[model samples]
Target: MIKFFRNIRQRLLTENKFSKYLIYAIGEIVLVVFGILIALQINTWNDERKAQKVEDNFFYDVLLDLKKDNANLNYYKKFHTKRITYLDTLLTYVRNPNKTMGIKKFGMYTEPLFYTVAPTSYETTFESAKSMGEFNNFKEKQLVKDLSQYYADFVQLENSFSSITRFVENQFEPLMYKLPEGYMSEDTGMLVINEEDVQEFYNKVASIKDNRKITYDYEIILKTPNTENYLIGDMGRSYTALGKIITRQEVLTKLERALNKTIKR
Candidate 1:
């Protein structure tokens, strides 16, 4: 192609009649410039196609992640709500005078830990974060950079939410488990419990509750003359874990918005 153009240029210059040759020369130059522009446009199109492919893969991953996060958030929410109902009933058991009638202590409804601790369900968004790398070679590298930073910020917020939830969930073990013995009877390895012994167990219950308090040493729940520390497990507001899962749901909503805009589009 180069040789053909060169030959045309040389032939035109050798002609004495310059008018016809000048027009031909101008036309050839125009064709060459047009050809170069077309090649550049094709290159740009190819790059865009590659970038779109990367974005498509990334969006699919983010969609799956959001769905998982949403499902997990819901599961934790349900877990927390049921726990609250049980906790409220236990509170009633604590305050009622009928507890002395040998009514079993509020152990049955709260005794799951005797058999097994309720397994915590976990949801992860890190897969979406990792998948954004599909766009690493994209012409618009900023797409990946921006998405990665967004995910980082989101995950940090998620961690904070988890910390709050841990605080709440941490309080639950003490309530469900009677002692190191859990909800089981120490003498018989049975779950049957009596509240007559439970009033006597006030200090023991407080001891268990106290251990879960933030101020284990300050001695707040220790009733008069019974100075035994009631503290047992990590302290937190009862619904704190459930609340964290709820907050994560909010984060998932935000993540979905981001992914749809950045990836799906």
Candidate 2:
């Protein structure tokens, strides 16, 4: 092609017919300009293709992360449900006034109560943090904004959860909830809690149980009176951050399907 153009240009320049030669030179210039424009268009298309691939790869990674997060959150939801139940029973045994008559005293459940039924921060904490970071760094601005507000709210909810956990463990345990009262007796006494005092124990343990249930329930998207204002407000602001992530994951799968289809085509 270069040789052909060079030959044509030389012929036009050297030919005796000046009028024809001038027309031919103008035509050669137009052809060169067209060739340059075509080369530029091809380069621009290649650059866009590479950028879109990078964007797609990042989106897929975010999808994988969100999918794992969803699975983990589900597991923790089940786990906390069981833990709350155990704590309920343990607290009942320790605090129940009427049910204490047994070979072993109600004191048996006191230590286990705190250990087995203690409130815990579930998988949402880690997931929220990861999701927030991903949202912030995403190449897609629309997705970033949509996810950012939601995740911010979820993080606030998680923080309130942490606060409640700390409140129960560090402060409330000492003042409100008492430890197992024990007196070593050489003679065996029927492990007994007088019926009159049962109500008092029930009331105390119930408060703790209610607080724990309220906090744990919030994590699972459950509603309750104890729902902290900070968490509620933040969560409201976030606009279902969790659902957004799930939606994005679903979209990513769809995009993958479309990409696969195009590849086959």
Candidate 3:
């Protein structure tokens, strides 16, 4: 194609038709410029396609992370709900002067209270994307806003758990320890052992046959300074954690929907 154009130009120059040559020269320049523009447009299209692919992959990984987060939130919600129920039971037993309870049964209820399930979040994908500035590539402004808010909620959720943990360590656990020996036992079905360690745990518990030595005295426990207060604190903290989890789930759902729309595009 270049040789053909060159020959035509050479013939026109030889014919000495200066006006026609000028017109032909302008036409060639216009053709070259048009071709360059088309090439540039194609290159731009390719770059955009590649960027879109990267964005798609990033969002897909984000979706997977969100799914994991949702599962974790569900688990925490259920766990906190059950904890609140146990705390309620303990509170009721302590509040009612007419009610009586045995230490063994009380131990079963109180054992689980000693443990705290801290909130867990899957933010690896988000952190990676942020560190690399992938978020800037996102075209949907609303999606970016939702994502920022969604991850921010994780911080609040963690703070809630920290409060619960501090209460357990500083007040609740110490007070419970002051109780009579065997008031709370390790074999009270509170420990969650892995499947592989289940048999070993059972063997250890079985070896300690005479574990229950103290009997529950409702009046004594009720009279113990701040026992009811600690129980109430525990319930309140658990309730707070539950509320955070619920809110997080809603935000997650919104983010997931935004991601679905962006990924489809």
Candidate 4:
């Protein structure tokens, strides 16, 4: 093509058609400029396509993480609800001294409150996307906003959970150990007291004929009422926070499906 254009220019110059040669030269320059522009446009499209793939991968990982988070939150919901029930029963006995005998049947409802059952949120992928500005690949501003808000809320909830955990281990567990021979189970969080041990604690309480001993022994048996109150309040807050996280996880699940569908199309 270059040789053909060169021949034409030389022939035109030899024939002294200067005006025609000038027009041909301008036309050739225009074609070269147009070709360069088309090449650049194609390169830009290719780059965009690659970025879109990266965005899709990020969303896929995020969807998986959300699913895991939903499951974890559900498990926590059930676990904390069980703990609340145990706490409620024990508190009721504390409120009514007559019900304290029933506490023997309840087997000293001492759960391993110190055991942390924190939810697992796989947020590394999301954080990586944010730090690298991969979110820009997504066209929908609302999606980005929703993701940002969810992660921000997660941080707050996680911190609250950690604080509550520390409080339980440091303050509440020691108070629990002072109660009786029964102790908390390592695995199931249920208190484990031999029948003999239970009877012994009951016998000691029953034999306390002196009014002063009765009051002191009962107080000793339920030594952690204040600790329980703090735990109940904190655990309630934790439950509420977990519920919110579950709700957001469900919403994000839907969003993930929608985006995946749209991308596939």
Candidate 5:
């Protein structure tokens, strides 16, 4: 193609009809400029296509991460909810003058520790999106906003868990050791709970007028310097953190669905 254009230009110049040559010369320059412009446009289109591919891949990975995060959030939600329930049972057993402290009450307090450790979210995709500025590449502004909020919520969740951990290590666990030896047996690693006492504790707790409610007054709960209050406060913190995680998970689920639809298109 280059040789063909060059031949035409040479032939036109050889003819030397000066005015015609000038016109042809200008036309040749215009043609060369047009060719360059076309090449540039094609290159730009190719680059854009490559960028879109990269963005799509990021979206898919983000969806996967969100799915994992959602699963973790669900797991912890149920786990924390159960912990709260058990904490409530123990609290009821302690506050009621009629209910005696026994193995059952001890188990209620200790069982929550089985799931006290919070689960961490899958954040690799989110971190990559932030660090690589991939969020800027997204056309939808809501996606950017959702991702930013989701990660921020995760940070808050982590901070909340840290507070809970400090309380457990410094206050709650030490207080547990103060309980009577029969309540918690070190040798058997089981609270020597009587079935009748456990059932009676449950019945009394179940009979409370508002047994399901979580009291948020940490000061009132903590003022007595009782182990029950420390456990309640700790569980309350865990409950609040898990609530935030659930809310964030909902947002993440919406974002994931939106992304999934977008990538399919």
Candidate 6:
């Protein structure tokens, strides 16, 4: 192509047709400029296509994370719901002057209170995208906003769990340790038995103590100051955590729907 253009210029120059040569020269310049613009346009299109692909992959990963988060939150919801039931039972027994509960049953109910699971979040894709400034380039601004809000809500849920965990550690566990019947082992510094699995716990304890029975009157626990108040507070916290889990599930559903629409587009 270059050789053909060169020959045409040489022939025009040799022919001494100055005016025609000038017109041809202008046309060649215009052709060169047009070709450069087309090349640039093609390059721009390729870059945009690559960027769209990256955004798609990011959205796909985020969807997977949201699914995992929903499942985890569901488990937490069930757990808190069950814990609230135990707390309600304990509170009822303590509140009534005539009601009484056995030590074994008390242990079982209170045992669940001491354990807690923090709300889990799967934000790896979001975090990575944010750190790399990928979100700035994202075409779906609403989706990006929704993702930010969702993760922010996750942090709040975690704070809710932390409140209950702190209460158990700082207040509830110490009060329980002060109760009768040696709940903690003097040997290994561990709970002597598992309240949830009473049969297995009894068997293990019996093997160690030649069929000895662990006994403590529930009345002693009931008489302890602030015991009723602690149960109330714990129940409230459990309810709060459950509410957060429920709210998060709603947010997850909305985010998931948005993501599905974006991905389809």
- Using TM-score as the measure, which candidate wins? 3
**Per-residue CA lDDT of candidate 5, range 14-131, in tens?**
8877787788779989988999999999999998787788778877888888888887777667766766766676667557646555544454456345334545877787687778
Q: Which residue runs does candidate 2 get wrong by more than 4 Å?
A: 87-96, 101-140, 175-265
> What is each predicted model's overall lDDT from 0 to 1?
0.49, 0.43, 0.78, 0.64, 0.66, 0.79
171-210, model 3: which lDDT tens digit per residue?
8777776575434345565533121334454446556656
The count of backbone overlaps in candidate 1 is 7
Candidate 5 at 255: error in angstroms?
Answer: 1.9
**Alpha carbon lDDT at 195, candidate 2:** 21
TM-score of each: 0.57, 0.52, 0.89, 0.70, 0.73, 0.84
Q: Pick the candidate with the highest lDDT.
A: 6
Tens digit of per-residue lDDT, candidate 6, span 71-180: 89878887888888888887788778587676556766776677787666899889989999998778998889989988987778888999999999988888787665
Candidate 5: list runs displaced more than 4 Å.
100-105, 129-142, 179-225
Give the residue spans of candidate 4 off by over 4 A: 95-108, 133-138, 182-235, 254-258, 261-265
Give candidate 3 regions above 4 Å deviation. 180-187, 190-203, 211-219
lDDT of 2 by residue, 1-265 (tens): 8898778777867776778778877988998899999999999999767655655655455445555645544443443343344335544443444453342332332222222112222235335545556434434665544434444444543553454455446633452232222221212222222223344444454344322222211111112223233233323322333343344445545544543433311
Per-residue lDDT of candidate 1, residues 1-265 (tens digit)? 8898787777877876588678888898898899999999999999888777766665656567567657755755664565555556544444453543121343344442222113222223344445555445554465445545545545544454455345445544543332343322322212323212443343354344334323222112112122111111111232555665566567567757766766644
lDDT of 5: 0.66
Per-model root-mean-square deviation over C-alphas: 10.5, 13.4, 2.8, 7.8, 10.0, 4.5
**Higher-ranked by TM-score: 2 or 3:** 3
lDDT of 1 at 245: 59
Clashes of each: 7, 3, 1, 0, 1, 0
Put down candidate 4 lDDT per residue, 1-265, tens digits, no spaces. Answer: 9999999999999999999999999999999999999999999999988877776677777777777777776666665565666667666666675655433434446543545555467788889888888777676567667767777777665765676677777766677566543321222223432212344444554454543322223345554467547656655755765566566667767767766674532
TM-score of 1: 0.57
Pick out the ten consecutive residues of candidate 6 with the lowest summed lDDT: 186-195
Give the lDDT of residue 253 in candidate 6: 96
Name every residue pair that clashes in candidate 1. Answer: 165-241, 206-230, 207-230, 210-231, 211-230, 211-231, 211-232
